[model samples]
Target: MTHLPPSEFTLAVRHETATLTVMIGGELDYGTSGDLLNEVSQQLTAGQPPPADVRLDFRELTYIDSSGLTALLMIHRRTSALGATLHLDNRPARLERMLHLTDVLDHLTAPPTRAGGWQPEEDDGLTEAGMT
Candidate 1:
């Protein structure tokens, strides 16, 4: 686990079978998204043959604004360009709702789950969360 300066986020990187798993915590707002981006960039650049998978664990993320969403999208695009897969895991309910509402959930590779281990089938459509 390594901590980066100038951000509240912490990154725990683990290598397994050509995959790089990054567990991220804290707010991924505009203020801290750059740090995360930099961390990913550094790891990819330093890898011997490029990573096969970049798994992002979002179980501890407390908040994610528009900028944060954009960052994630950017990272996904970059990883795809590098011929790597990006997987998101354990997204918070609020964030999940936001992603669905934004019509971006289909682009995510992670399975959706509710607070109580309820896994909704894909194509269930978006749920309203009182956010507009």
Candidate 2:
């Protein structure tokens, strides 16, 4: 049986005036998906005002699975509930393919609607190539 190396994941957060950017590195598979969710949760409730935008920087992300996608959706929901927009930045090619194939790339990166709902924009003015 082929063996995979121990899953290595890390999150480095940068908080700005109205945005919280989390730079993620390494695999975000089942073994480490929860780390992303927990980190977001903790940051969201750390007595500071909730950010108007939550950005997940995937510049160094190496891999992801279904669980990771689920985590992204969950984070989207959480941010939307607080009237915040979710941004998936610097997505790698594989991750972009996965998000598109899973039909959640737009959902995870949508802006909040007037009714406080989440819906993909027709022209969000963002492209995978420009994300980086």
By TM-score, the best candidate is: 2
- TM for every model, in the order presented, reads 0.73, 0.80
Candidate 2 Cα errors over 4 Å, as ranges: 1-7, 114-132
Model 1 misplaced stretches (Cα beyond 4 Å): 1-7, 110-132
Give the deviation of candidate 2 from the true structure as CA RMSD.
Answer: 9.2
For model 2, how does the per-residue alpha-carbon lDDT over 24-82 read when each residue is reduced to its tens digit? Answer: 99998776777787788677666456788889999999898887887787778767866
Q: Model 2: how far is 32 from its true place, Å? A: 0.6
| lDDT, candidates in the order shown | 0.68, 0.77
